[model samples]
Target chain A: MKSEKQLVELSLKDDKHFAELVERYEAKLSRYIFHLSSLDSASTEDILQEVFIKVYENLNGYDTSFSFSSWIYRITHNEVISFFRKKKARPQAISPDDVDEDYITLIPDDTDIPKELKRKELAAKVKKAVLELPEKYRDVLVLRYLEDKSYQEISDILKISINNASVLVNRAKEKLKSKLTI
Target chain B: MSKLADKILKKVKKANIKHKPRWQFIAKRIFIWSALIVAIILLSMSVSMIIHQMTVAKPVFSEHFQKREFSPIFKLVPYFWTLISLLLLTFAYFDFKQTKTGHRHRPTIIVASGILVGIIIAAVMVSVRAPHNMEEQLQRHPLYQKMHFDKDFSKGPGALRPLMKSQANNPLAFPKN
Candidate 1:
C-alpha cells in the first residue's frame, strides 16, 4: 500500500494526479448531493470545489490508517448537506406544491442496471425518499443506501457512532418507505 | 461505464480544475514581482555594504596587509547567510503559488517569516549593544577588570551586569516580551 505522504507528494508534483481524485469521485457525489438538493450545475460545481479545497487543506490530517476515498467522500457529503442547510433557509421560491408526484418505477432495474450500478433505480428511489425525510434522517439515509456504504463507513463519514448510523438509517428508511408510497 | 459515470466524473473533474489562466497569472504575477523587488533591494544593500567596508578600511588593514573590517551587525558569520535564506523562501513561496501545491502552507510561511524577522531584529540589537556594554563594564568594575575576558570571562559578564543595573521598577508599563 502506498503511504499517504507518498501519494500527497505525488499529488503536489502533478495537478493531473490530483485531477484523478476528482475523476474518481465527482459524479456519484454530485448525484448524491443533487438528490439532496435541487441545485443546478453551477451551484453543484461551486460546492464541489469547496469540498476539494477542504480535502486539499486537510489532506495532511488524513489518518493514513483509513481509506482516502472514504475520507474525501465524507467531506463531500458534509459539504452538500451544509449546502442544503444554507439554501433551505431564507425561504425557497420553490414551494412543496411545485414538486410533481409522477415518478415512475418499473421492474427495479434488475435487467439493465450495469453491475457497477448494482442497486440502480432502487438506489435512486432511496435517494429521492431520503430527500423527502426529516433533515437529520435524510443525510444518514442517502449516505448509507445511495452510496451503499457499510455502517462503519457511514459512521466515519457522518461523524457519528456505528450504532447511531444504524439507527439513523433505519429511521430514514421507515420515513422513506412512507414518503415513497405516497 | 464512462457515460454512466460521466455526471459524477464531471464534479470530480471540476474539482481538479486547471484553476483559470487568469487566477494563476494573478498569483504568479503578485508573488514573483514582490519577491523580485525584495531580492533586488537586499542584494543592493549587501553589495554596497561590502564595497563600502572594503573602500573605507584604514591602510593598516587596507594595503597588501589585507585585514577585513567587520561591522558589529555583519560580523561573527558569513554575510550571505541572511540573503541566501531570503532567496530560498522567495523561491519556495513562488513555487507553491505557481504550482498550487503550497496554498495550505502559505500560512506557515507567513508566520515563520514574521518570526524570522523578529529574531533578526533582536540579533542585530544584541550584537550592537553587547560589545559597548562590555567595554563600559570593563573600565568601571575592578572585580570584572581583574577577570578580563579569559577562561573566567563567561561568569564575569553575568556578575558585572547585576552591579551595573539601576532600577527594577518598570513604571512606564511596556509590552511584555
Candidate 2:
C-alpha cells in the first residue's frame, strides 16, 4: 500500500487516484463525523461528500510536514462546526459502541470475561458522561479516547496548543470519573 | 467504494476547484499577527497617556506638592481612552484565536498576560516622557492672570480659612522663598 503522502502526490496528478484517498478515509471519517456531531447516517453521508470535496480543493496547498490524518480531521472538524452553526443546534449524544477494548483494563483488571462485561458497562457510562460534557471538553475527550489520538494530533486537529489539549483531557477524565461514580 | 466516496468523486470531477496558493494563506496569517501587534501597541499608548496625566497632576518628589485636597483634575482621567484600549485588546484577542495555532494556549491567560505586558510598556513610556507639572502649567497660563483666582482656590473653599488665620498670626504664613 502506498503511504498517505504517495496517495496525495498521486491524487494531485490523476483525478481517479483521489477516489482511492476518499475510499481509504471514508469509513473512519464517517464514524468521526457521527461521533463529533448529531448528524444521522444520511446527513453524515452528505457532509462526508462535502468534506472530500474540500480535501480535494486544498490538496495542492497541503503541507507535507503534518500528518495527512490530522489535516483531514481538522477539515472535518470545521465542517461539523459549520454544520451546527447553520442548523443552530447543539450536538446530540453519541450512541454506545464496543470500541472500549483499550479502556477495559482501566475498569478493574480482574478475570478476563467478567471484567470485560464490567468494562463494557463502564464504557457506556463514560460515553454518556462524555456526551454531557461541554463542547470543548467533549471534543478533547472523544479525540483522545475514542479516536486514540495523541495530544499533538488532537492539538493539530483542534487548532489548540498541546498544553491546552492535555489540560482538557485531564479535566475531561475527571469529569468522566465523577460521572461514572455517580 | 462507499456511496459518499462515489458521490464526492463525481463532484470533484465536475467542480475541479484548484488548490489555492500557499502564499495566500501565509499572507492572511501574517496580516492577523501584524494587526494583533498594532492593537497591543495602541493599548500601551493609551495606558501611557493615562499614566502621564496622573503623573503630571502629582509629582512624587516635590516638597511643595500640597496634594490638593479637592482638585477637579482627579475627575478628568482619560477613562474613554482606557475603554478604547480594552475594546481593541479584546478585538485582538478574538482575532488571535482565529489565527493558525492560536488556540493552543488558554485564551484568558494569554489576553491577561498581553494586557499586563502592555501596561508595563506603557509605564516605561511614561517614565521616558518625563514629568510635567500640570498645576505649574495652569498657573503660568494667561487665563490664570486674567481671572485673579486665588492660588489656594484649587485646594477648596474650606482650606482658605486656615491659611488666613495663620497669615494674620505669623505675618508670614509661608516663609520668604
Candidate 3:
C-alpha cells in the first residue's frame, strides 16, 4: 500500500491512482459529511462528489508539512461551509437516530442511569444536545468525538490554533453537560 | 472500487478535469507571501515616515506649545501618516492570515507581532536615515511641497526667524552703528 503522499504523487500522474485515493477516503468523508450537514443522501453524495473534484483539482496545492487526512478534512470542511453559505441557511441539527451508540459514551456526563431503557433515553437526549450546539461548538465536538480526531488534527482541519481547539472541546463538553442537566 | 469512487472517476474522465499545474499553486503561494512581505514593507515605511515627521516637527511643536500657538501644533502631528500606517497594518494582518498556518495564531498575536516588526524595521530605517532621504525626495514633489511646506512651518515662528533676524541688521534701523 502506498503512503497517502505517494498516492497523491501518483494520482497526479494517472487517473487510476486517483481512483485508489478516492476509494480510500470515500466512506470516511461520506460519513463525515453526513454527520456535519443536515443534507439528504443525494445532497450528501453531491457534496462528496464536489469535495473529491475539488481535492483532485487542488492536488498540487497540498502541503507536505501537514498530514493528508487533515488537509482533505479541511477541504471537506470548507466545501460544507460553502454549501451552507450558498443555501443561505443555518445547518440544521443531525438526527439523533443517525448518531452511533459508541459516540454517546464520548459525551461527558456524570449521571449514571442504571436501567438500559433510561440509558438509551439519555443517549438520545445527549445526541440531540450535541447536535443542537452552536455551530462552532458542535463542529468541534463532532470532529473531536465522532471523527476521533486529535486536537492537533482538529486544529488543522478547522484552521484554528491547537490551544483554541482544546479550549473549544472543553467548552463544548461543558455546554453539553449543562444542556443534559437542564 | 467503491461505487462512489467509480462514479467520480467516470465523471472526472468525462469532464477531463485535470490537476491544476503545479506552477499555478506555487504562483498562488508566492503571490500570498509576496503580498504579505509587501504589506510589511509598506507598513514599515509608513511607520518610519511617522517617526521622521514627529522627530522633525518636535522642536517646532514645542516652540508653538510654549508660544501658545495651537494651529501649528495640530498641523505638526503626523495624522495622515498614522492613518496610512494603520491601513497598512490591517492589510498586513489579513495577508498574514492568508498564509497556511497564520490562522493558528490569535489576531492579537498577529497584530502585536506585525506592529513590533514594523517598529523594529522602521527603527532600522530611521537609523540609516532612510526616512530623511524619503522626506527629501517627497519635498521635491510640488504637491507634497505645497501641502507639507505650507501647512507645516511656512508661516510658523521658525520660518519667520530669518526675516526677523535680517530686519534687525538693517542700516536704516541702526544708523549709529
Candidate 4:
C-alpha cells in the first residue's frame, strides 16, 4: 500500500487514485461527522460527500507541512460548522443507539460511579453529558478522546494554538466531570 | 469500494470535478505572504516616523513643560503616524493568522511579537535617519507642505511658530537654533 503522501501525489496525476484516498478516509470521516453532529446516516453521507468533493477540489492547496489527517479533519470541521449554521440549530446529543464500546473509555476514571451501573449505562450517560457541554468544549473533548488526536493535531484541526488546545481539553474534562456528578 | 465512496466517485466523475490548478494555490499563498510583509514594513516605517518626530521634538516638548503649557504637548504627538502604525499592526496580525502555522500562535504572542519586531526594525530605520529623509522628501512636495504647514501655522503652538516659519523656508532646517 502506498503512503498517504504518495497516494496524494498519485491522485494529483490521475483521478482513479483519488478513489483510493476516498475509500481510505470514508469510514473514518463518516464516523467523525456522526460523532460531531448527531445527523442521521443520510445527512452524514451527504456531508461526507461534500467534504470529499471539497478535498478533491483543494488537493493542491493542502499544506504538506501538516499531517494529511489533520488537514482533512479541519475541512470536515468547517463543513460540519457550515451545516449547523445553515440549519440554524446546535448539535443534538449523540443518540443512545450510537453510543458504543468506544465511548466507554471517555468516562474519566476520577468520576465516582456506582459499581452497580453497567458499562453500557455509564457510557450512555457520559455520551449525553459530553454532548450537552458547550460546543467548544465538546469539540475539544471529542477530538481529544474519541478521535484520539494529539494536542498538536487538535490544534491544527481546530485552528487553535497548541497551548489553547491543551487548555480546552483540560476545561472540557473538568466540565464533563461536573456534568457527570450532576 | 464502499457504497458512499462509490457514489461520491460517480458524482465526481459525472461532474468532471478537477483539482484546482496548482498555480492558483501558490498565487494565493504568495499574495498572503506579500500582504503580511508589506503590512509589517509599513508598520515599521510608521513607528520609525513617530520615533523620529518624538526625538526631533524633544527640545520643544521640554520647553513646553518648563513653561507649564501642557496642551501643546499633546499636539507634538504624531497622531497620524501612530494611527497608521496601529492600523498596520492590526493588518499584520490578521494576515499572519492566515498563514499555515500562524494559527499555532496565540493572539497575544502574534501581536506582542509584531510590536517587538516593528520596534526593532523601526530602531534600525531611525539609526539610519530614514524617517528624517522621508520627512524631508515629503516636505519638498508642494501639496504636502501646503496641507501640513498651512494646518500647523493656522493651529500650531505659538512657541513653535518660529521653527515652522524657518522650516517653511528651508524644509531641512527643522531645529533652527
Candidate 5:
C-alpha cells in the first residue's frame, strides 16, 4: 500500500482518487458491510464498492468540513437498510424438500434431528433481530456493535448529535441483548 | 490515530467511483452541459421578456409611456402563449433526446409525459372553447353605445329595472291605482 499522503495526492482530483479510496477501504468496509447485514464476504465487497461509488459521485456536493468517511458511511448504512427492505419485499426463501445432511453438517454445531430447524442462520437471525429494532436504534447498533463506529464518528456519519448517538447505541445494545438472549 | 479510523479511512480511499464505466462520465458531462444550456436559455428569455415589457409598457415613468402608443403586449397573450408552448415542447424534445438511454428513466419519462399530456389537454380545451369566446366578444363589440344610455332616457331619475325588485307579494310597495 502507498503512503496516505501519496494516495491522497494521486486521488484528490476525482475518479482515480476515488478508486484509490476504494483500494484503501475495501477490506475494512467489506467487514463493516458484512456486519450491517449477514451477507457473504463477496456480497459485502460488492455493496462496499457501491457505497464508494455513491460517495464519489456525490463528492462535489460534500461539504469539506464534514468528514468524508462519515458521509460515505451514512450512504452505506442507508444502502444496506434499503437493501434489507427490498429483500423483505421479495418472497422469502423456502426450505428445500431434500435437506442435504451434508449441508447441515457444514453449519456450526447444533443439537438433535432438526428438519424444521435452519442451518447457520447466524446471519439471518441477526438480520431479523437487528432489523426489528427501530430505525434509529437499529442504525446505532449496526454502526456501533457491528461496524464498531465510535459515537462521535457515528454521529458525524449519521448527521446526529453525539449524545443522541450514545443514547441510541445503548438502547440498541439493550435491544440486541434481549433478542439474542431469547 | 486509532486502528479503527485508520482501517475505515483506508477502505474509504479505495472505494471511490473511478472504477465505474466510462459512459457514466459522459452522462455527467451531458447532464451538466444540458442543464447549463437550458438554464442559460431560460435566463436569457426571462430577461428579454422583462426588457420587452419595460420598453412596451414604460411602467416606471407613466409620463414617458403616455405619449407613446404603448398598448401592452398582454393583448397578444394567446400568441405569446403558443410561442412559449412551442419552445417548451422543443426543449422537452431535446431533453428527452439527451436523457434517453436504452432503458428510459421512469421519473423523467413520467414527467415528460405529464407535461406533454397537460399541454395537449389545454390546447384541446382552448380550441374547443375559443369559437364561443370569439363570438361572445364580437357580440359585445357595439356594447359601448348599447349599455351607455339607460333603457328609458325619459325617466330622469335613474330607475333600476323592474327585475331588480324582489318578487315578494307587495315587492316593496303598491299604490291603489
Candidate 6:
C-alpha cells in the first residue's frame, strides 16, 4: 500500500488520485465532524468539502514531520471553528439517535452506576452527556476516544502542546464522569 | 466513493484546485512575518513617542504651581499616535495567530509576550531617538505664544506684525535667574 505521503504526492500530480485520498478519509473525518461539532450532516458535508479543497490548495505546504491524518484533522478543526464563528452560535447538541454501540463501549465504566443498564439506554445518556460538555473538553474527548488519535496527534490537530493535550483529555474525562454520574 | 465524496471530488476538479507551489507558501509566510515585524516596530515607536512626549512636554514646575486655575487642556495628537500603534499591534497579533504553528501557545501568553517585546523595543528606540528639549519645543508653539501675550496679541496690531521666526526665543515670562 502506498503511504499517505505518497498519496499526497500523487494527488498533487493527478486530480483523480485526490479522489482516492478523499475516499480514504471521508467516513472517519465525516463521523468526527458530526460528533465534534454536532453539526447536521449537510453542514458537515459542506465543511468537509471546504477542508478537502483547502487540503488540495495547500498540499505542498503539508509538513512531512506530522502525520497526514493529523494534518487533515487540523484543517477540519479550523474549518469547524470558522463555521461556528461565522454562525456566531454554540455548537448544536447531538441527537441521542446518533449514538452507537461503539461509543457506548468507548465510554469509561462507572462502578457506582448500575451495571445492569442495557447498551441502548447507556448510549443515550452518554450521547447527551457528551453534547452537554463545554466545547474545549468535548473536542479533546472526541479526538482522544472517538477518533482514537494519540496525544501527539491530538496536539498536532488542535495545535496545543502534548502535555496540554493530555491535561485537556484528563479534564474532559473528569467532566464527562461528573455529567454521567448525575 | 460515496455520493458526497464523488460530488466533492467533482467539485475539486471543477475548481481546478492544485497544490500551491512550495515557493509561494514560503513567500506568503515571509510576507506575513515581515508585516508582523513592521507592525511591531511601528507600535513600539508610537508608544515610545507618547511616553517621551508626555514626560518632556509638561509646563515648567514653577509656572504650573503659580497658576490659580488648573485649566483643562486637550492634546489629542500624542494619544492619537498611541491609539494607532495599539491598533496596528492588535492586527499584528491576529496575523501572528494565523500563521502555521502559531496556535501552539495560549493567547494570554502570546499577548503578554507581545506587549513585553513591544515595551522593550520602545525602550530601546526611545533611548536612541531621545527627543531632548521637547518641553522647550512645546513651550514655543504659536498657541502658547498667543497665550503668553494674552489673547489681546491676536486681537490687536501685534497680530498684524506677522508671526516671528524666532518664536523659540520668546519667553512667556523670564524666570528668576
Best DockQ goes to which candidate?
Answer: 4
lDDT of 1 by residue, A33-138 (tens): 5655656668878787778766655544555555676688778878876776777742122323332222222122233333453344445554455455677786
Evaluation by lDDT, superior candidate among 2 and 3: 3
Residue A68 displacement (Å), model 5: 2.8
Give Cα-based local distance difference scores for all models: 0.51, 0.68, 0.79, 0.82, 0.50, 0.72
Candidate number with greatest lDDT: 4
Proportion of native contacts kept per candidate: 0.00, 0.64, 0.78, 0.80, 0.04, 0.62
Candidate 4 residue-wise lDDT, A1-182, digit = tens: 99888888898898778889999998889888877777788888888999999998989988888999999999999999999889897766555666665777777789877888777777778878877888889889889888999999999999999999999989888898888877
Model 6 chain A is weakest, by summed lDDT over 10 consecutive residues, at A105-114
* Tens-digit per-residue lDDT, A1-182, candidate 5: 66444544455564354456666666666656654455655556556655765655555445444555666677887777676676674213322431222223212233223355455454455455565667787677767765667877787777665667877777776676566557
Q: What are the per-residue Cα lDDT tens digits for candidate 1 across B120-174?
A: 5435543454323433444486664443221112353233232223223211111
- Candidate 6, residues B98-128, lDDT tens digits: the string is 6776666666777777788888987887676
Model 4 residue A5 CA deviation in Å:
0.5
What lDDT score is found at residue A44 in candidate 4? 85
Best model number under TM-score:
4
Off by over 4 Å in 3: A89-96, A110-120, B62-75, B140-177
lDDT of 3 at B68: 100
Candidate 6 Cα outliers beyond 4 Å, as residue runs: A37-50, A78-98, A102-112, A150-152, A159-171, B1-8, B14-24, B54-85, B130-177
lDDT string for model 2 (A1-182, tens) is 99999999998888677888988999888878766664677888777877888898888757687899999999998898888888898766544563344443222222223334455565555555666778888788778876889999999899888888999888877776665556
- Report the CA-based lDDT of candidate 2 relative to the real structure: 0.68
DockQ of each: 0.01, 0.38, 0.59, 0.69, 0.03, 0.33
Model 5: fnat (fraction of native contacts): 0.04
Determine which window of 10 residues in candidate 5 chain A has minimal summed lDDT: A98-107
Pick by lDDT: 2 or 4, better one: 4
Report the number of clashing residue pairs per model: 5, 2, 0, 0, 15, 0
- Candidate 3 chain A weakest ten by summed lDDT: A111-120
lDDT of 3 by residue, A114-150 (tens): 4554545656666677767888898898898889999
Please provide TM-scores, in order, for all candidate models, with all chains considered together.
0.41, 0.69, 0.83, 0.88, 0.39, 0.68
Candidate 5, superposed: residue stretches over 4 Å from native? A1-9, A12-15, A86-128, B1-177
Comparing to the true complex, what docking class would candidate 4 get? medium
